[model samples]
Target: EAGVAQSPRYKIIEKRQSVAFWCNPISGHATLYWYQQILGQGPKLLIQFQNNGVVDDSQLPKDRFSAERLKGVDSTLKIQPAKLEDSAVYLCASSLDRIDEQFFGPGTRLTVL
Candidate 1:
């Protein structure tokens, strides 16, 4: 099966600017997740969606970050007034079920200057 897809493989922006990342999960998958991975650290869950409804977003930085999975398929993540700390790899993953194996996208690497 086709894997996850992501856009703008890389991004460079100044602090406080706005940026958005897009993702398309695997077909037939029911669970999608967005994660932020800083250098030398594991990917931290930002948000999780089971189909069109949100399942978990405890780690999402609501102050400047938001996301949506309107159709329960593709999704987008946006950061308005981005912070320097936001300069990291944003990853999108999907699983057939909550306990199933997850497939990850290539990710969007953000750099803040």
Candidate 2:
């Protein structure tokens, strides 16, 4: 009955600093996703999780970015040695199934200096 939840709605860091974002998906949802929206650009999928397993992460920069959906309910995304270009809104969404329309949470805005 609850919508998704995210913490620390905003974050500020210098380049090379590390940051982590958290997400709690809606109940009964089976698929979860993380996305990054850079200024002026549409959100790009960063990772997809079906339950506790990874479904897709081809576009994610594994060298600096990583994510996990622990126990198939809540998730976390992290960036190490972050770059200025990493500044963006990090969005979390969930759906009943992979093909279902997703419900999104208010994103976490990260500002890298």
Candidate 3:
């Protein structure tokens, strides 16, 4: 495939609500990542997964955000009790390995009231 895949291209929720986004990586890829991109700011890595294991989540808000990549292919990211600050684009990216370049999916735009 040419790139990664993501679902529910857009979502709108009020503060204190919850939302989930999904992603599917290119075949043969082994690394997946989730990023949050706020308007006027660069995308920030939220989580990284290698196969079915977690690699990094240091920048993720543990109290509100959760993510998992199952079977090393599909991934999901969730946010609970969303806040206004959570309004941003959720991007999914995948690569063959940590050192390889990544191919990103069209992002999921989230609007939190």
Candidate 4:
């Protein structure tokens, strides 16, 4: 089975600039998630989608962060007008179900200058 895939592995942007990351989950997976992992900290759930509908996005920062999973397949995360504190690893993960084990992508590391 194909594993989760992410791109641009790393990024550097000035504070207040927008940045985006992409992800592709495993085939046939029904659940997708985006997480933010700051240095020296565990990953924090940012958003979750079951198929094409959002299951949870309570942790997402509505003022600056947004995400979407279209066609219930690939997904994208965008941080607009980025902040210096937003520097961290943006991880994309997928699971067969909400309670199942998740497979994670390599993640995109974003740095704000």
Q: What Cα-based lDDT does every candidate model obtain?
A: 0.96, 0.96, 0.94, 0.96
Candidate 1, residues 1-113, lDDT tens digits: the string is: 79999998999999989999999999999999999999999999999999989999999989999999999999999999998989999999999989999999999999988
After superposition, candidate 4 runs with Cα above 4 Å error? none
- Encode model 3's per-residue lDDT on 6-58: one tens digit a residue: 99999999999999999998998899999999999999999999999999999
| Clash number by candidate, in order | 0, 0, 0, 0
Compared with the true structure, the alpha-carbon lDDT of candidate 1 equals 0.96
Find the 10 residues in a row with the least total lDDT in model 2: 1-10
TM-score of 1: 0.98
**Which residue pairs of candidate 2 clash?**
none
- Superposed by TM-score, candidate 2 places the C-alpha of residue 33 at a distance from the truth, in angstroms, of 0.2
What is the lDDT for 61 in model 1?
Answer: 85
TM-score of 4: 0.97
Tens digits of per-residue lDDT for model 2, 1-113: 89989987999999999999999999989999999999999999999999999999999999999999889999999999999999999999999999999999999999999
Better of 1 and 3 by lDDT: 1
Any runs in candidate 2 off by more than 4 Å, and if so which? Answer: none
